[model samples]
Target: MTLKELLSPVKALKTLSFATESLILTWKEIASLFGLNQDIYTNPLHKPLAKPVTAILIGAGHRGNIYADYAFIRPDEVKMVGIADPNAVRNGRFARKHDLPAENRFYNWEDVFKREKFADAVIIATPDNLHFEPCIKALEMGYDVLLEKPAAPTEEQCRIILETAKRTGRIVSVCHVLRYSPYFRQLKQILEAKTIGEIISVQHLEPIEYVHMTHSYVRGNWRNSKTTSPIILAKSCHDTDILRWLINEPAQHVQCFGGLSWFKAANAPEGSTERCIDGCAVEGECPFSALQIYYRDKKRLYVFDLPDDTRKWNKIILRNLKKTNYGKCVYRMDNDQPDHLTVNMQFDKNITASFSMEAFTSYEGRCTRIMGTKGDIVGNMETYTVTDFKTGRETSWSLKTDYHGGGDHRLMQDWVQAVGHQNAQILSSTIDVSVESHLMAFAAEKSRLNKTIEPVILGV
Candidate 1:
């Protein structure tokens, strides 16, 4: 058996006995003598912080809450000292959870900055359109920033954020959480080790599960590209960043094709009403019925702010459904994001990648295939397999998945450590590198709209 097979759990267990265990341990020692060990390739999340990193949270919404949660589990590594969110309910909820003092809580982001810089870093998880201002202000005030993805809604804004971070000499680690995922980290190691030889091409897919598409892109905050941001930047920029990272080259050319297909008024069922709760005849049969999705199935209700009373949840949800966009019929909403899109990209070293974002899939996860000179790798985000061409040997690993493949918490850990030591090297998605991915995404959207291949121009 090969070294990996010998070390694999199932095979190692089979050889476990008083004598065999000792023999296998000796073999493992001998194998380590050749400079091969599983421990060497770890992307460790736990690290000693030089000092605790205190941060101010801007926007206590979903993404904001997710990143701040890291503080609760590891208070020594990071602490939330201040919070600014427009919504009182969300702000109060976050403040109570983090135990923020009354003086530290504010009703607006602008108020957080009116005072002198109070924290080592700022976590800006505001809405897409609101990111640029707070990020710029926070960096100017000498606080390192953990800005949410897309950076901003425009190419110029993304570039400006990068430039501001550079000019101010404050660290800006964009929230490209996928880079911290164990599965992708292993893939990066395989390529860096030349286990798959030189890279050639890659195929990546982001299957935005159907329910998620309707909830977010069709009926929710990101329904209009003009208001929030294009779905490419809002959703699939993560994929673009992953492709750019895997290829390890500056993107040269991009061509894209897709459009808003099935979620418009033209495609609504014959008897459907503008709202699901309006006694629409087809509400019972329609899968996109808000009543079914929110009231009955209770899937995707995390976006809603319900009451504290568990017994009153149904009443509050139904009431909000009537008042908010959440109850709107999917087919009649003012959404412009494409249901399906494909992008072809060329990088500096003859490396190429094709990425597809599909909103029709029943399941969600990134599926990827990377081709190289020696062999290829294939994986869904949870598991991956590498095959060797010469020996016909295959090695596989199955990872225990969590939020964003356990990237959310892992990124927070690394960011806190990086901020504590004032070292950018600890992060994988620093602003300079992340801006390139956003530029590529902008180029893809231009290509799709103009029906011409677009050259990716870096910087402001």
Candidate 2:
């Protein structure tokens, strides 16, 4: 068996923080389900079972580097064939680090797809605004795709991408990595089976944490709601997607109330300026050094082992902060995108959801509660538990996922395996379920802007 298939229940179960008995039961269940207990074997896949699927990573920024690691998980099923980015420096550095062939690396995505049109699939890890064009083109090129989340920024784009997938007979899967988490999948299965009995309401709070808010919104590319559409699309797309997935219904209406409540120039602690190091007395006290921290961070990922030149790092980091719709000063990086926002959504079948994104928290894992006719379920992502309503018990099943960048690897693996199936419905046929989640975000934004409850729409 492959290392993944043969993973001991004890080992996998250990990642979660469930009560001892619950942990053991979960492990036993997984083992029994796969019959791993009966068919105990060693190194069934000393070699990878699937041949490497050649792929071109369309975005060479942060996420582009991540998808490259799929080759590490199942090297036989994937290979890094190329990278595409508009910036020559980022493109070159990413190509060198991931060992993408020099000839395969292209500065523009269209150049690769138009002139060569190579690879079994393309991974569109590009920025939110750029997703639709490449996705439509990738499908047209007859290549299956792994498109990153907030699939597209607008409802129109979402519809277009989904429509093309339907027309072209190609695969398009979004990076809803949380769905593949063994922890969540188990919880969801139990909930759907009515271990939670007719889930009626879902309460979800995404503790974006001040640090994460700063990383993606303040200092990174996602700070601008105008550019990326609030913390909802930029960061909480996963959380929103999780809510939609948990309930398994179309959210018919949405109303949210919140704003850039923290991290603003007006709220800047007494005497703090626009810059972190320049004329700021608190630079020494702050852990999130705007200059030194992100300075090293920017290059370490994008330029590691490639160049001695520090200029590119400076340029990217400075550009990101200057354009920060989130904030500029380290003490005031809480710009826009609502420090705390609450959403109320009603599903078509009368199911209800309450979703919140908060900037201030103990910086822990996500907390989820699903209430149904039969029972209520609650779990912390860090603790990994799902309380049983029937017995008033919560079991431990803390999930194991890439803590740093989310679970892109497993998501990619599932997408590949699904696509490999000959009669795959979603792998190469449909993408509406994923696309609709993004449309919900767009509707949420419209609600936020227009100050009215917006009706959600999903296209087939």
* lDDT scores in order: 0.84, 0.68
TM-score of 2: 0.79
Q: Which pairs of residues have clashing backbones in candidate 1?
A: none
Error of 2 at 268 (Å): 2.7
* Number of the predicted model whose TM-score against the real structure is largest: 1
Among all candidates shown, the one with the greatest lDDT = 1
Q: What is the clash count for each candidate, in the order shown?
A: 0, 7
Query: What TM-score does candidate 1 reach?
Result: 0.90
lDDT of 1 by residue, 1-460 (tens): 6889778755554334322312222223322322334342243644687667999999999889999999878888999999999899999998999899999999999999999988899999988988999999999889999989879999988988988888988888889988877678767767777777899999999999988999999999998999999999999989989888888889999999999989998888888887999989899998788999899988877777876677887987898789889999999898999999999999998899999999999999999999989988898977776666775545555664222355798788778877887778778887888999999999999999999999999865
lDDT of 2 by residue, 111-159 (tens): 7776656788888988887888888888898888888877887777788
Supply candidate 2's per-residue lDDT for 48: 35
Which pairs clash in the backbone of model 2? 1-44, 16-398, 18-396, 259-338, 263-334, 326-335, 387-394
